[model samples]
Target: MTPSTWSPAQPPAWFEQARHLAAVRRYQLAEELTRRELAQNPRSPLAFVVLSMLLWQQARYDEAEAAARDALAVQPTYDEAFYFLALSCASQGRSAEARAAIHTAIELDPASAKYYALRSRFELEWHYAAQSRATAEEGLRVEPTNLECLHRRLLALRQLSETSLAEETARNMLALDPECAPAHLALGELLLSQADYVTAEAYFRAALRQQPGLAAARQGLSESWKQRYWLSRRLARLDAWVARAGQWLTARGLGGHLVLLLGFVLVVPVVCLPLCLAYGWSYLRWRLAPAILLVRGRPLGQPCWQCWYRLICPAWRWPWGCWRPTASGARYGASRRPNQSAIT
Candidate 1:
């Protein structure tokens, strides 16, 4: 079976009991097994690595990092140990350290698709969409059937707003694995971006059917429902029509629109000039009237020009605060999508 579809019953024989315990989230028992293995063979890198994974499963990142380091000390060339160390560091928000460790892991085992996918995820988190896509593409080159790499590439393209390319990639993913939940969710998000609420909703529903507990798919479904409401749907249709009209006009060249704008400007000047004149007169009267109240015809404190400047040029600010944008925290369950190579 492929790595993504790994079953708990699969036999590696060496760490059979430990792996089974960890798979079932029995981290305490898994730790005991690893401890026994280490007692039997103190210099065994695999035992230390298992201990690291068990600690990682319990969110004990610092302890996990130490265990991974111990594994590396026992076997300097342990790529999987380095991979787990990177994951532990990343979970603790030490991104720079995490990136460095992940890079070292990749350098040691460039053929491992999981390393490349993790690197891509880091790049994307750092807002390096192009680099993320390149890394995922490299992973795909190494393992053409790797679903995680494909999904990472799709996500990177979406971040870059390369919608057409993202759509093609999503379609390719579905072709590779029709039952893949992430592929369905990716397609749903792509369609949602294009304002195809009806189709997007269907894709999200399909994803939910495949993986009922998928957080991202459920969040996508909620957003699709919000967009599919009657008023939002009507507004979306109008927006689409306007977009089509704009495209048609552009295809015909800019001259037509320029002529239309010219006509509007000419007509507005005639109607607006008199009103402007009247308003200007009233403003002058108001300002002079204020000055008349000043002693010895001296002007008031200030012209209040600052008020006008503020009105003309409002303060620069974002609608939201300076926080990184994120999806509705759609985390795949830790148990279902085990970070096997990277941590487990």
Candidate 2:
């Protein structure tokens, strides 16, 4: 078909193939197919959108945003293009632009529960917990059983200190999909905060069983182990108390920026001195952790990634700060990115 004579009202076979490949995470092959399709049909907005998705998967956020923009230029009403643009911009730390783009997308496709779910996650990640919860509720209104929205709602609830609601949301998620690692991880975090280390440890272990590479789950497992000891538990309690105090300051209608400022001026002055002394004790304990484990005849605690003993520890299951190993001995993509989503 000639360029001017043809419209991409129906995507070509290659476009479908590329979409399937991208869904299956065969990014390089999907990218190649998408590029070829775009070359043949330069005006195809959907082709550009696929290219944007491919680039985003590769973490080439600038290129991804450009491709999304190209899609928008080709078809001004392409909501998926705007959604991809928002994701790319978010990845690049252009938060305001990303929010605007996502708002456009949501306005264009109000029925798309995924858009609201994504927005909820964006809000939570950016520290707007109340807004995040609202967004998640919007998603749930569109699709009551949406797991993504439920998980984000759970997280937002936790952040807002609505523990009862958060636990109920987590139970709903587990009821929906027992294998959902994110739900398990959230529940584990909740239990950890409540000082229920044994139960939290089980949940963390379940999360890891479902997704071994989940950084947050691994970290939670290590934390649960640390708190099994009385001395470390006391230190952890002190840290949690300080954090709660900061939250109390933040709740008094302080500006978001002032929360940290007041935390430094008010909460930290009273808390951090003792916290620092506790940290000194923590450092000494961290150094002696191996000896303590040996004395207890327990190697269950993961060797601290930063500890000097990690290189020599038999219990070190994975590389430092990584759950997987690559040919280079460091995990590929092992820049310690936050385990944002629990799907591995």
Candidate 3:
């Protein structure tokens, strides 16, 4: 027998228990309860939406998508179902489908700032930075103080390299909620990108103090700590080439990997041999520079420590020499020299 459709003004007792269980993350009990609810009210769109939410939380995007579609089947005009459908599609990297579903949700509920905020998030992921900003702006217009919309706008600004605007947005967030961890986090990330480790670390620490569970803040703090050491900073700068090379290789797919393998095994040594013969002595000489300075009982200047970069990396000029990339393919400005006081 089809469960009689009644006014869902009062949720069933099991629905309340299931929500509580889900809130506390006892998903198995919650799912069991939800299934029981389904058994009693199999035609309930809300039950399917709840199930979709639970499945989405568990990272079961395919199942969540199906549950959301089931909800839509029960109620063609279910905006909530469309929202979950968009979330599941986005999680599965179906950005176009996600956008389409979210657009439908917005049409169904034009005044929903929540849907707009979510749509802005996926727009950013899809690399529509300008569109994301506009979506976020519209969401803010709908509800001026929506924190999620503000966060999305801040991120879109950051992606567009509008540092001043991003900072302004972050500060506005802090003004609205002084203890917002994500606000602190956004500022910390911006500072980190600008190589202001001290300020970045302070902001990251502040974020962690507010939200002890913020993994991004912890990671930023760790990176700030790592960048404090000279060797670590130089190694990171040196590895920038590796990251670029990996991107180039990735773009070319398997062919680039094959070339890389062949070059490393057969061509690199051949091409490097001549340079090695010429600079092999110089490398050994600098390799022993610290020892030489120590033996001479003279203070080791910065050059003694950093000559390796100058010799091997053509782009690494004298610290603070400041070169820019030219049409000739020269590039510069990866790392900076340590402060004289810090060096001392």
Candidate 4:
């Protein structure tokens, strides 16, 4: 159909539905509808950018990169295209490229909070936790109450091992949004790490209250309980072992235990001696010998017993064995000797 024949209403129906699906995080259906819209209007940069965002959300980084690039090719200054391209690059550990693309995006729209948010995410992935915090701080300066920027800064602090700062950030995040499960979880982790088990348990319980399916908080609580239990058990076992070893040393006497220890030490080496010798012999004959011969520019498969032995141990020299004369040496010798006798 011609561009004129495809009414604005037709594009809006698919685009609006796709956008709604994307809003609810139903990326798969959003992607399908966006593709359908693009089929109708192949040159639609908006459709391509939407599809790229959906692909990125689904963690299909390569496809998202391609789609985002296509969108940028159609509209070089498209902010959304650059944003998704940066996200695709960041997800795949291409931090330098992602940063460059995000810089371009920020240049296109300096006031865009999303561009700064994505840059912060890129810094976090690149192991520049300090830079991530700075980026998030910049975003907060631009949009004072941006929850995303606040969350990013909190996570960056946590990664940098600044637990006290992370706890404060988490409290701020919870004050802003009481149902923030991630903030509660972060607070719990900080508290647990500081050995404040009572407060940590309460935070973990509150996190679960906010989001019943908060697996990470549940797992952290479970693991913390397990670790405390195991720590006490391990200490008890260590104490028992020390007591038993001391009693044994005293009752058996140092000389008797020393003799038994010596015997135990000697037995391992005695058992390993034959295997070690065999391995050393094989290593020298196959690997070291052939390598030395190759270094000396000698034909590795020369008509020598050692070369033949090396050939038999093909694990050392593969194609070298293929050219070994040992297999045909007897025939060559017989042929040469007969010809020499006949001439004589």
> Which residue pairs clash in candidate 3?
none
Q: What's the lDDT for residue 272 in model 2?
A: 79
> How well is each residue in 1-344 modelled by candidate 3, as lDDT tens digits?
00111123678777677677776778878787787789989999989988888888788999999999999999999998999999999999898899899999999988878888999998898889999999999999999998889999999999999999999999999999989899999999999989899999999999999989999999999999998789998899789988999899989999999998998999888989999887998987755554443334422343444444434543333333323344766333323445578878
> Top model by lDDT, which number?
3
TM-score of each: 0.63, 0.63, 0.63, 0.61
| Model 4 CA deviation exceeding 4 Å by range | 1-13, 23-25, 209-215, 226-344
lDDT value, candidate 1, whole model: 0.79
User: Each prediction's Cα lDDT score?
Assistant: 0.79, 0.81, 0.82, 0.77
* Model 3: CA > 4 A from native: 1-16, 210-215, 228-344
Q: What tens-digit string does per-residue lDDT give for candidate 4 at 1-344?
A: 11111122345667677767776778788788888888889999988887887887787999999999999899999987888888888789887888899999999988867678778877887788999999999988898677788889998998888877888888888888888888889888888778677778888888999888989899878756754676865886798998998887888897869977998899989989999999999977765554444334444344566544553564534555333455646321122123556678
- Least well predicted 10-residue stretch by lDDT in candidate 2: 1-10
Candidate 1: segments with Cα more than 4 A from true spot: 1-14, 233-344
For candidate 3, give the lDDT of residue 132. Answer: 98
Give the Å shift of residue 331 in candidate 3.
65
* C-alpha RMSD in Å of predicted model 2 compared with the true structure: 26.0
